[model samples]
Target: MRCQPPLKSMVYNWLNNNHACLLCDEPAEQPYPLCVACEAELPWLDDGCQTCALPLPMQGLTCAECRRRPPAFYRVEAPWHYGFPLDALISRFKYNSQWPLGNLLAQLLGRWLNHRYNEDLPRPTLLLPVPLSRRRLRQRGYNQAAMLARWLSGHTGIACNEQVLTRLLDTAAQQGLSARERQRNLHQAFSVTTSAPIEGRHVALIDDVLTTGATAQALASLLLKAGARRVDIYCLARTAKPGSA
Candidate 1:
């Protein structure tokens, strides 16, 4: 396919996802959309715990939470933290009704996944996003995590299990919950809706962010119960602070 003209980038973006932010309705840009400043100020989640991907200190190795109880999703890969540009960007994408950003973020995540997992990382037979409750889906009009999984499937050769896992619980938001609290809040929140036999197969759980890994951990348990041999999380952003998780 030929490249689109620079002037039509915004228009193309709009056409791709109703021409709005994935989380918000603010005007977006071409391809990735969102304003330039928002792109620049994106809270890139750098230097986090390799396993949990929670922002870590330069000296100490692991956070108290990870040390006490490690996350269940094997390892995490996030491009940004859940703050600043990413927070605002995700705000527009999630709350503001900007849906295209979901695809954009997915592409970013796919790029990273390809680089990290293609060579040595265990490849997943399927990509399943942590599902959003119907209420949240109705309120938000879309599931951002699902969109990320779709994008990953499109780019990588991994199969997309759109309905493999379902969010059975409509628990409270995890914004301020402690790691333990978050785990408790999400405990038994998810169940497998479609039991695709994954006996000895690897699976990747896609999500927009990995706050405390509780959600991912909970989902992993369910997927494992369903015979998924391994579970890895593919998240767009991770918190850049230990306490944040």
Candidate 2:
């Protein structure tokens, strides 16, 4: 038999390859940014609507809203609930140009998606970032969703196309709007670019967060209208309905 390396030498090599946790600055227990403890403590969405990924108390059941009116996207996959440090980190990444935070979040989500694909989740033919209107893009100096999509693409070898969908209207922010108001606000808000090749293809829409999902519905409808065979939503986090657990 060939001579084997010493156990001490193997341990030293393993330690050198470990990543540092972004949150605590300690040696990460996994390949992603956070240590095992930090990751375990994250506000993960353990149970939710199968179609929209809306957070719910019970698993294996659809939410009443989805049962009544389903979203345009056929399915949603998100890793976390919009709460705690995640919300704060996303705010900083979107508003303050803090790209490292966005990178950390993208890595976490990408790892989750990789595992999901292994479990037979359908991988889209194309990945598209939800478009930011010209006005908002100018004001913010960047589109957070695009950044996240690019980062995820790099991680998972998925090709991301940012120019396929265009935000036609610079609708007011959706933060203060109720569900109905949000849907109304996004009416006719998105249009497909003439050059986009959408026919008979499955597409995934990437975004930082999925709130009421009105925006997602509007865009997914446009993609389907443009002849996409199926559409899926991929976001870093999903918010619970008001007063929901």
Candidate 3:
């Protein structure tokens, strides 16, 4: 027999009377990890390239690189820029395996996406987290992108299929790679797991951060090749170089 748990957790918060801010030690304002002031002070990406989510001086403009050689994905939306305490928080959440931090980050991302839903943007039918190689998955014990996607799925009622897309190779870390180098490294690194009908579906690719966008481009290319009509990217933050504009 199969037992299905309720959509919402039945457990009550008896551990602490108030939820402490993840950035500061102060009490947070309802459901978020940061207090109102800290939230306001976050490095929000108010202006960026719509195509790739790279931070820019002006809004609603595509970068030169994107204009020349556009990414496989149509657009990307991220709430914050990868900087300062934000980077530190993500490091603790990702590399350190701090579930609470990851949860908090995911919650913020959900809120941002929900706000976008209220606007003009439409939600994707399927949410696919950028997959990790099996070797990396075993070494890390979990895929942070999957964790965030699942959390977002539960809240937004969007179906998340982590098994749909996969990493076929253990590519080198993309942190220090140039754009061309990263693209080369990600070649043949991702693949689709099933021959399911993805035709004409809008798929949202979720990830922790958008940097260089090599991985997202590779995954988006694969999804498009598998028959997806359009691919959109959603990430918590974007890392644009100082003078990359």
Q: Provide the TM-score for each candidate, comma-separated.
A: 0.78, 0.89, 0.91
Can you write out model 2's per-residue Cα lDDT over 75-117, one digit (the tens) per residue?
9999999998789889988998767678778888998999999
lDDT of each: 0.72, 0.87, 0.84
Better of 1 and 3 by lDDT: 3
- Report the lDDT tens digits of candidate 3 across residue range 1-245: 73634322311232134777767879886665579988888889999997998888898788988999988999998999998888998999799866667777777888888899999798899999999999999999889999889988976788998889888899999887898999999999888987384668998998999988888988888999988999999999999875764
* Among all candidates shown, the one with the greatest lDDT: 2
Q: Model 3 lDDT vs. the true structure?
A: 0.84
* Candidate 3, poorest ten consecutive residues by summed lDDT: 6-15
Query: Compared to the true structure, candidate 3 yields what TM-score?
Result: 0.91
Q: How close is each model in CA RMSD to the real structure?
A: 6.5, 9.0, 3.9
TM-score of 1: 0.78
The runs of at least 3 residues in candidate 3 whose Cα sits more than 4 Å from the true structure, single-residue gaps closed, are 1-17, 242-245
Which of the numbered candidates is closest to the native, going by highest TM-score? Answer: 3
